[model samples]
Target: MSQTPPSCPASVEDVFACVEEHTRPLSVEAVSLESALGRVLRERVIADEDQPRFDVAAMDGYAVRADEEAEWLEVVGMLRAGDWQPQQLEAGQAMQVATGAALPCAGLRVVPKEETERTGNQVRILRRPADTCIRLRGQNFRAGDQLMAAGVRLNAGHLALLASVGWVRPVVTRQPRILHLVTGNELVPPGQAPGPGQIRDTNTTLVAAFLSEWGLPVQSFRVGEDEAEARTFLAPHLTGNQPPDLLLISGGASVGEHDFTRSLLEYYGFRLLIHRTAARPGRPLIFAVRNGTVAFGLPGNPLAHYVCLNLYVRAALQRILGVEGGLAFAEGFLTEAWNPGRSPWETLCPAVWKLESGKAQITLLSWQNSGDLTPLRHANAVARLPGGEQPLSAGSKVVFLPTHPL
Candidate 1:
């Protein structure tokens, strides 16, 4: 008799609740400014000074006091970005302030370069119509104000903001370390010759690449064959001197006789959080944790693994690390309807094209076998379908999660 799949767990909330109960963040480490990219901030970073640091010029022109008679003032001295003016602007004199130069207190207005004329130390202001080009001190942000709250990832923009606020040295949480294990019996290492029935190992490479994109470094390994050999290979990596913040195992998550990833997880002292989900292609996904490290068991198929890695596994990792705002999902309407051969639940297929009309049109990638990876390259989004007996019509609205989380 066919065994019924484990109960659906009521909803996605229940699955996440179980996942949250088992997983926790890894220990924190300190890194320098250059090494802080992709790491989360552990503490709130306050600005020590204003962003502009002074009332400065927003254009390369003359800085003069704003009054009815101050409009035609003469340029007394020039102030470049790094130079300072020893004398402030007098009643009839203005200082030449370049873009980003600090403005003296006597200057209250700035005329843009295109709107002024200069000869020697003298200048004529043309467009002093209003207070248009003065970047006032503390206008963008003030000193002692919270610039970036904790849990923000340090990206290029964040770095620029921090530098503007005089944060030469800042504190950031260390990137989460991952231990990746690829398990299969018919795999061959890259660059090695593969005979019939053997395929090159792509899982390890893909997993490592994906983790690296998220600012996480992976200590990855590969194992082959059944339960005993797989468990033995993983024993060292999972229990070694540098145990991973997250353990990712690809393949051997299904119910086949050789699929020992789930069973052996219990052997290695992990509590199963969720054995299955309602999503297609990655329905057999599993999550577990031991000693505060999350273990994610992904489907063996490359495309399926690709989907789950971004959707479920990434979510679990971000939750523990206190990282926020990195999750990405897209919305599109279905341009073409599809039906998988023999599944009760709706399958999330890779979208081939998003139409000019803003509709998502896709069919199963040609010859899309579970293990085939050709579809992954052409796919950019995972189109969703609600559970129902009737087939969906074209142009139907649906939600999709992008494979690239950025």
Candidate 2:
């Protein structure tokens, strides 16, 4: 007799809490600024020198003493950017200053060229200078000031700031290595025609691509339906020198006769922290950790695998890296009605979301099932629907998780 699949016993919030409680940031390594993008900072960065080190002109204008009331002044010299030598400004003397050029002396104010008229070295002030147009020394940032705090994910802006602060090499958390195991008897490699009940293995490729995009080192291997063979294949990854930080097992997570992923994991001393989650399209998700190696047994369906990876696997990676992780949710109104079945688990419906006339709107796609991947092509976001007897109507407010960076 076939056994019934076990119901998901963990809520979404509970699963997240469990991940946070168990996961710790990986060890730190010094990486050059050129290769530090998207890496989490392990040490706080301090400014080595004051930004603008000296007072500089904010506009292309003439620098003069604020106390001078002379309507006309003689331009003694010109100061271009990078001219560090100080030039004295007499009571009626002025200097032509370019934007970013250091001010000649203290109490000097810049008069924009547009507000003054010049004939050769002589210039006439057209209007009273209300603004100084001067960037004071250390105005942007002072020396020894905190440039970036620890635990920040370095992006383009962060990298630029680090470079500005003279940090050519910054300490960052090391990326976790991943090993993907594709298991199934009826699965065939891609680019080949499937015979009989066999289907091409797409989950491995999908998981590998996701890991690669995240800049994580990943390796994939195939395992047949036999539990003994699967154990042998996973044995090398479970323990040894340079073992992977995460083991991603595709397929064989459910309570089916052919499903041997959970049993094999147990045999290898993997302790299950999360057996399942109360979320659709990923109900059979499994998370286990042993000896600092984390493993996830994802479902066989393509779309289900994608959803679970985004929800669970990504969370685990963020936790291990000591970086904050969560889907970017935006508020939008439904353009059409959607009513999936009422269950205890929340439903996430794929949808196309766009901004029209400065207003955000989302339309639910025509979904077939978890196995269908066609709908994902048109889906840029996933709309969240609470589990209840009531169906969502058009114009109802909802929150959507974006698939791509918005």
Candidate 3:
């Protein structure tokens, strides 16, 4: 039986919970460490061996007994990086060790070259500074120590750490197959000059860039306003063995006469779970599913698309990638007095923020309406303003989410 779509939730946070119930993590695969960035790690990465493998010098200095009372010690040997020579250091002896060279013995201190004067065969300890410039074995991590837990998203630093532990090919959740359809006869490509009653489409580039943050690829196309033709164009994709894992249709999500996203998804056997949201600019958002594939019908307004993509669609992608937990909102203080105006619904306003002395200070940007996209250029974060009429003063605490791609 076809399921009826639910009514809009009272809060934007509930919308996140509704879509999360229908999705699960995609299958996992083994990929090279180089290609693992932005991919959620599926296995526990442990230290293959003690990090550094041995006691190595942190810098070029003389390795000597910390309590050596010799006026001048013999230069036993010169050790460079990758050279491991274990020679016992007596009370009157020292080793000239280069940066990253293995220490000859324990109970030794590294006197920096700046604090010592070296002669041809004998070096004089001009000053015996109490400093140990050695990177001890197991200091960073010990053998079998858990370096990364499952479900951690791998970044460049995480990849390097994995490679150092011999994880050349790490298992990660596969990225979802996304099919994007832009619906509207009045929409034209960004390069083309728009005629009367037509506007250039910006949702394609916007959606692509957002997906690239997680290294996911999107297949995009334009479907006209005619519901029948749009169904015919998308019917094959839902039937084939390699159907998209997630479907996104830009525009046609409202209650207008031309809005057909809800009916079209039903005809394709998709169960509409959500038809609207309680957030400003993104109220007409649609979330549906067919079997395991998730779908979202975004509003035609450019800013609405941006807002929905950042909030709801992002939540779905997180579940599919096996990233644990829900959408996290951080607290920030407002830098200026502003108001999103009086609205019964939650407002997801765009803003720019920076950390000052470890505290987030936000400056909310303004927009004429949901159709406005110019303000997004200055927005690096999204601020959640609860329904109220009072203007927020400077340094008022507010919740926000950073919109960084990485």
Task: Please give each candidate's TM-score.
Answer: 0.87, 0.91, 0.95
Question: Can you give the lDDT of residue 329 in candidate 3?
Answer: 77
Model 1 per-residue lDDT at 189: 93
Q: Compose the digit string of candidate 1's lDDT tens values, residues 1-406.
A: 1123255632344555666666665557666677777777777888777766677788888777776364456767778888766565677888778898888774478778888877777677766656558778788888888989877778888887876665656666556667788888789998899889998988888898787777777877777767888777777777787667788888888778888878888888887767787766787888777776788889888878877776777778767777655455556666666545455665667666556754555444543566778877787766666655667676666677766534
Pairs clashing within candidate 1: none
Ranking of candidates on TM-score, top first = 3, 2, 1
CA lDDT, every model vs. true structure: 0.72, 0.82, 0.87
Per-residue accuracy of model 3 over 1-406 as CA lDDT, tens digit each: 4487665453686777777788999999999987888999888987879988998888788999878888688998999998878888988898998888989888888888887888897988888655587888889989988999888889989988987888999999997899999999998999999999999999999999999877899999997889999888997888989899999999999999999999999888888888887778898888888888999999989898888888888888889888877777799999998765677777899999899999999998899999999999999888998776877789889999888643
- What local lDDT does model 3 show for residue 391? 73
lDDT of 2 by residue, 1-406 (tens): 1122245467766777777776777888999999998788889888878887889999999999988899999999999998876867998888999999988789989999999999888999888668899999899998888887887788899998888777988999987878899888888999889999999988978887777667777888888889999878777767678777888899999889999888878888777777777777787878877778878899989888877776677778877887755545689999988775667578767789999988789998876788888887887777777776788899999987766421
- Candidate 1 wrong stretches, greater than 4 Å: 1-14, 68-72, 86-88, 119-121, 325-327, 340-342, 352-367
Q: For model 1, what is the error of residue 40's alpha carbon versus the real structure, in angstroms, after optimal superposition?
A: 1.9
Worst 10 residues of 3 by lDDT: 1-10
Where is model 2 more than 4 Å wrong at Cα? 1-8, 325-331, 355-360, 404-406
